[model samples]
Target: MVERMKTYKAIKYTLFVCCYLFWVASAVLIAVGVYAKIAKEGDVVDSLTADPALLLISTGSLMFIITFFGCFGALRNGVPLLKLFLGILVAILLMQIAAAVLGFLFSDLVLERTEQLMAKGIARYREDLDLENLIDFVQKKFQCCGVHTYKDWSGNVYFKCSETNPSLEGCGVPFSCCIQWKNESVLNTMCGYETQTLEERIAKDSIHTTGCLDKIVRWGKRNLILVGGMTVGLLGLEIFMICLAAAQISRIRGKVKTVNSRRRAR
Candidate 1:
């Protein structure tokens, strides 16, 4: 009995540590999402469509609340709370499976929607400095420009290719679209200026003429194995925790039953 108690205690403490770390990670995710939303420069759109930050905040908040129940339920050895946690975890797992199936069935629609959201972001780039910086960073990191192609910058009024536009940046992509030279220490902010008006051959040499949508799609395809591996690993961890919690609950109940049997015998 003492050995059983020791084993139970060890499992409980280990589960507590794991759940506590999950809680902390969720909290950090929420904080980063909030900071991104609040510190964003310029116009704030409260629209809930395709905003990664909002999605992160929502997911993190949900995880934090659910994991709170799991952590405390294990620490206190509360049967009811543990049962609730188990139910929720199962439901979440099922929902994730359903989502994956749906995503596979409607991949084309998903890609189209993704492109639309990206185009919307580009259009609203000037309205939010944070968004602008984010778009610029994506372009630089991906080594791609615009949504479908560099010509898609015409969607942005500031970069619209027209001789009549008043903005000096008319027909010009952001500096991020410019070819980055290895030895060059300074970025020429105006490197993309007037490049949109040039011929395709010339523009391709100076700027990334390819679109980001295709590059992003390609990247996702290339890393499918990695993403799938991570997903499986996380699900495996969750299942292990559930099994651990269930074992602890059973151990406690059996010990209680043994004590009750002894009392009845006496």
Candidate 2:
């Protein structure tokens, strides 16, 4: 009986420690997100649809609430709280599986929606600093230009190729699209200037004329194994946590039953 009790205590504390660590992490995420929102309030409002800080805050808040239930339930051996936590975990797992299946079955639709979002982002490129930086980073990393092609920059007001466009950046892509030079110490922000006016064959030599979406798709395919492994690892960890909580609940109930029976006998 003492051995069984010891085992129960071990499981309980282990679960507590795991939940506690996640709770701390969630708190930190929330803090950083709040700080970002406050520091760049103007920028965040402008990019409301694509604000990274808002994403962080929402994700962190959900994690914080879930981990709180896990921690409190484990420490107090509260059956209801533990059951709630287990149910939430199961629901999340199901949602993830459903999303993955839907994404696979409707890949074309997914791509189309992604393209639309990317186009919107491009259109508002100059309106949001965060979005601008994000687009530039992706372009440089993938060595690609606009959504479908370099010419797609025409969607942006400042980059429109119309003769009436007065902006100096008119008909030009961002510097990120430029072909980086070897051993270059400084970036030539104007390297992409007026490149859109050139023929495709000629422009390819100076800047990346390929679409970013194609490059991203190819990159994903090449790293499929890594992505799949990470997904599987996360699912396995969640399953393990669910099992631990279930076992602890059973132990608590069994102990309660034993105590009640002994009291009735007396």
Candidate 3:
């Protein structure tokens, strides 16, 4: 009985520590969401542009609430809070499974929606400075431009590549479309000037002619193994914590039952 009590204490404290760490992680996620919100303060588009920050905020808040129960319940040996935490954790796991199945079933629709969102961002590229920077960053990182090809820039009013367009940016791509050069110290803001009007062969020498979607798809394919590993790792950890909480709850209830029976017999 003494050794069993020691084992329960060890499990309880271990749960406390894990819950504390998870809580901190959720707090950091919330901070990142707030930072993203501030970074894109003036732009409020609800599509892909704003979804990331909102997702972070919502997920972090939910995790905070759930982990609070786990942390306090473990520390105080409170069965009610522990049960609540376990119930919510199970619900979350089920929801994740459902989402995965739904995503697979609606794969084509998801792809179409993604393209539409990207197109919207491209079309409104000049409306928000933060969004422009984000698009530029993605283009530079992936070494690709526009949605499916550099030619997709034609969808943007400012880069329509038409002589009739009055915008100074017409017939040009953003500097991010330029081929990055090693040892270049300064950015040439006009590196992509008139690129849309140039012949494909000629443009190939100075700018990325491919589209971002293909590059992004390729990137995901390449990192599939890594992403899968991380997802499994996180899911396993969550399951482990849930089990630990359940075990502790069982131990506490058994002790309570023993105490009540002893009192009745006395």
Candidate 4:
């Protein structure tokens, strides 16, 4: 019985820690949500200009941070406040999962739509258009859209843009093919093209953050899948902790009552 009580105590404290973690995850998710909200405000992510990689990265990072805490919520802590916090964390994690699913599923849809629009844009920009310049334009636009490789920044990769501007112009035109991060800049792959005119356009295409999500997306679905898988696992742990916490509370109450009754009888 003592052993059993010890186990229960262990589980109870575990729950508390888990709940605390979930509270943390909830806090991260909330922070990410706030950042994304600010970044994506107004026009939001539209069909024509959305950046899949950026979306995935920003959202995934948020999930990753929050889910870290979420996993702890699965322990056996017997605190109502912690439970409440766990619930919030779980809910936020769920929303993030939903967002990821939406981002993943609709990604191809947006891709198809945007590609079609690019084709149209290409067709429309003909006549006075520069075919050479168009290649430059396409390359630049794609690079700006978070659609390139990591080594591409090192100027070593065989990117689509490289074929067009084989000369020094294409080799060093970082802004010619990269996204601009607001209030944040990096020395490596980023192009600092701060456009006030693109404020609306920026609001439409990219997930808002002081960081870049492009790094993950250019490689395909792996990052998002990893993040989603992590979120699901963390969420499961949180649920377990919450349930355990509840059980511990009941047991603790029962033990308290028994001890008090015996003392009164004595």
Candidate 5:
């Protein structure tokens, strides 16, 4: 009985610690997300499809609620709450597996959808500061320009190549597409100016002519092992948590049975 009690306490405390850590992480995410939302409130664009703050908040909120149940259920030995938490975790695991399978089987569809989203982002490039920064980061990191080609920036109103366009940035890609000079002390933000109007061979000397999608695909292939390892690690942790909760539930039920039998004997 003493050994059983020790094991029960060990599992209960371990589960509580895990849940508490996750709860704190969720709170941090929520706070950062809220701050971002407030900072960008004045320049609110149609960011429903690509807003980083919304994504952070939604993910953090879900995690916060789920971990709350896990923490309280473990600390109080509440069977119903533990069962609810276990059920949600199992459901989330199944959804993740299903998403992975679907992504693999419909890779072409996924790529097409990704391309469409990238194009939308490009069109709204200047409308959202956060999105603009994100695009610039991707372009600089990948050493690539537009979604499919440098010319794709023509879809954006500010960068469109037209005789009547009054925007000074007209017919030019963002500075991110420019090739960085060796030991350059200052950035030439106008380096991409009129590059879109130049011949491809000539423009290649000034800015990256390759598209971002291809670059990203190659990058993903190169880091497949790292990405796969992280995915597996996350799934494994969820499975372990589920098992721990189940074990604690069983221990609690056994203790209750022991108490009932002792009362009957007395």
Candidate 6:
């Protein structure tokens, strides 16, 4: 069986470049994770995962440092350790995939949490928006929180009765309740607020307040800027790796040529 040739210098250098980037990214992620765990820690593990930024940093680090470096032996000339290199690469990819899935699951959890916050926010806004008076009027007349009796008074406010529609008088306010009350229908307690109803308003506020994940991205970006600045260092390492590969290839080729020449002379 023909033996696979050793890795060429060009390929080794390319890999070196890739690996250095990985190491840097990994260091940042692990650092951030540690910092959070130490400094702020459990304060953001859940949301950070949801934003997926930290995961990216972690995964990126693994891809470059672990997988690329692990496969470095394959750069040898005249007998490629292709299998070993490939195995390491595959393992790292699997890790990345797992991280991605976990991140997505976390995002879903955040979304659910945001929804709960929305409910709470809407309830809170009710008092501030003077929605209780509206509710009282509706309860006294229609016994619901909807607009089934009155008409649009001004802007988003409504004055109506609950005699026509009894269903929306209670806890049946849709987030999209924009119907103009015309007859003896119930008046919605928190329906009219410019563009947002009670539900929408509350949902937005809750998510913004509770589920907003800007901090994660901001931190990630700041770290990435370091990564960006280190591009010069990374580039230099890549050049060195290429030079190392070229020298190795040259050394091996000279040996092979010498062996061939001796055989021909004999």
Q: Which candidate is the best by lDDT?
A: 5
Taken over the whole model, the C-alpha lDDT of each candidate is 0.85, 0.90, 0.87, 0.47, 0.92, 0.42
Candidate 2 lDDT over residue span 1-266, tens digit each:
99998999999999899889989999998998888777763663444456667767888999999999999999999999999988998999999999999999999999999998889888988776667878999999999999989999999999999899999999999999999989888999999888889999999999999999999999999999998999999999899889889999999999999999999999
Off by over 4 Å in 2: 41-49
**Model 5 C-alpha lDDT per residue in residues 1-266, reported as the tens digit of each score:** 78998999999999999999999999999998788888884555646577777777888999999999999999999999999999999999999999999999999999999999899989988877778888999999999999988999999999999999999999999999999989988989999998899988999999999999989998889999988999999999999999999999999999999999999999
User: TM-score, each model?
Assistant: 0.87, 0.91, 0.86, 0.38, 0.94, 0.32
Stretches of candidate 5 off by over 4 Å are: 41-43
Model number with the top TM-score: 5
Candidate 3, residue 106: lDDT: 100
Candidate 3, 88-141: lDDT as tens digits: 998888888797788789988877887887888888787666567778999999
- The alpha-carbon deviation from the true structure for residue 55 of candidate 1, after best TM-score superposition, in angstroms, is 3.3
Model 4 quality (TM-score): 0.38
Residue by residue across 1-266, what tens digits does model 4's lDDT show?
79978977776677656545545665665565455445542433333223332444466565555444434433433345445545665676578679778867898786666555444333322122222244335454444422332222223221223545453423232243444456655533433222212343452343221211243345346566776677779777756755665666566667788899999999
Q: Distance from true position, residue 144, model 1, in Å?
A: 1.1
Please report the TM-score between candidate 6 and the true structure: 0.32
User: Where's the lowest-lDDT run of ten residues in candidate 6?
Assistant: 148-157
| Cα lDDT of model 1 by residue, 41-108, tens digit | 64465555545567668989998988898899889988888788878888887888898888899999
